[model samples]
Target: MEKTNVEKLYEWLNEAVMTINMHEDAPYLDNLAMAINVLFYHDTQNLNNDIVKKKLQTALENIQLEQYDKMEKSKAVQLAILTGMKQSTQQQHMMTPETVSLLTGYLASKLMAGHEKIRIFDPVSGTGSLLCTVIDQLQNPVEAYASEVDPTLIQLANGSANLLEKEIEFFHQDSLRPLLLDPVDLVVADLPVGYYPDDVTAAAYHLKSDEGHSYSHHLLIEQSINYVKEAGYLIFVIPNFLFDSDQADKLRGYLLEHAHIIGLLQLPETAFKSKNNAKSILILQKKSEKSKEPKQPLLVNLPSFKNARAMEDIMNQINTWFTGFKQN
Candidate 1:
């Protein structure tokens, strides 16, 4: 069978990355980043293998990366990144699944309409998957910004954006720390779940625990809200236990004061390995006179992505809610 362009791109890149991996002592993810750069610039100055160089040049000639659309380019690189993740221990850097990112993108597209130009942010942009995916979904020109603390993940993310030719400004600092970014129109993140160890830094957040370490996810939500303009929306993939934890009251209090609940979609259990790790998509709008709570929130228990008929039904219902949302 003839290979699709995406498959071809992934296969060629994987071969080049493997060649680099054979010689480099660095991590596989880093090698994949270098391979992406080499593909981006068509520069093999660092790669001394004559045979692999010819093969890469041939792949570039046969496959026009420019001809591929943004989403296709993202998928190709995503395939490469998944290969790297399997060879490494950086499980925390996992990209949001394509299905979930598409779901978020659909919500963002509806939320961001009518704005000709807008700023968007992702506080924890893992490999730029969800951020870039959402950006591809928007019709307006976007000034995209993302931050990540991990060196490998950031490097891989930069390569992913570069290959897709989508310009995204990135910060390599810890997101919980003060960011220089101004308030943006929207914020999106696949919120990392765990306790933040920085007692001093966590102290500054309103969601900070009075006693022990603060939940990193809670602190992230607060920080992301701080960086969004008044009335702007925030979309988070939060764990199911987010509100059931011991610190739930304080977090709930912070939300009531700072934002309005927009929607919550409980994702299918099939998305996670265990029931305990299941997550839901939560939407919020920053508190402002202009952004009042919707009379009816869009609460849903999303069916498995594989269930086409049921998935379509949920989307139709969501569309109906969005129609009402606009009028509200």
Candidate 2:
């Protein structure tokens, strides 16, 4: 397929920013690129090089992207911007495209099987890639929402959603803190993993602490589970050790008591090439008060493949598993 003009323009804008030699000015440059993308998507008539440069400067000065006119495009410009952000030296967090695609496909299938409109959320929605992809892939309509801590990423996320003309509510705050929003149908995220030093919040939840270090990933799981509606799902990409680690016993016990494990797939180590740890996909359904005790969850051991062929096989297996689950 031929690349759209918006995509071509984004390439030029990214290359232009790369030549600027201003590391401290990278955020401004990123904002400039995003604003230019928004402008181009809305008004393609005035997209000459000179005009774009001037408008980008104006946008940077104002620190805003123009509102998008409603027009659906082939590829999301914000995703291109996200790629550029990942390439920049300052980008500290990112999930591989393979992981995102697999999760999106699985979620799309599950949501399509049901008839009701659903609400989906991501607590640590960096760049909004995961949320956007899931929304784009859904066969049925959905209300999408996400929260992020970094203002810059939130700007990029909102800008990308605008360029795609997708309606999504974005929250600029830490997702770890307790939320007062209504419960959602699905919670999906590639959760951040590390030893969180905030003991106060950990103690508040009575989270298990080991060697004076409480894992942030565990905390997120416990917190995210609370946001799901009865019989709703929580899908997360997390390190494999959470399944059997002594430190995670409390979290594991909590999950077993309150939710039904839909499935767990041990992904290829290469699936998260950007990080040094092995990862797994965990799918859990929040149990209804009247529901009976759930059966044991399906556990799949996926073959390790770094390329497209392997990813396809993994996705196929996942789809088949979902199909079987839906049938029963």
**What clash count goes with each model?**
0, 0
TM-score of each: 0.94, 0.77
Give the Å shift of residue 200 in candidate 1: 1.2
lDDT of 2 by residue, 1-328 (tens): 9965555545545543543323224554354444445454544343345554555455444322332222222243554555665666653345435454556456655745674787888898877667777776677778888988877677767766765667899888877787757899888888887777777777756454856878878888877878888888888877777767767678877887878877777776665654457777788888897543335465776665557687678668767766676766
* Model 2 worst lDDT run, 10 consecutive residues: 63-72
**Model 2 regions lying over 4 Å from their true place:** 1-7, 15-24, 28-92, 208-213, 244-246, 290-296, 304-320
The residue-level lDDT of candidate 2 at 279 comes to: 79
RMSD of each: 2.0, 5.5
TM-score of 2: 0.77
Candidate 1 C-alpha lDDT tens digits along 203-282 = 99998988999999999999999999999999999999889999999999999999999999999989877898788999
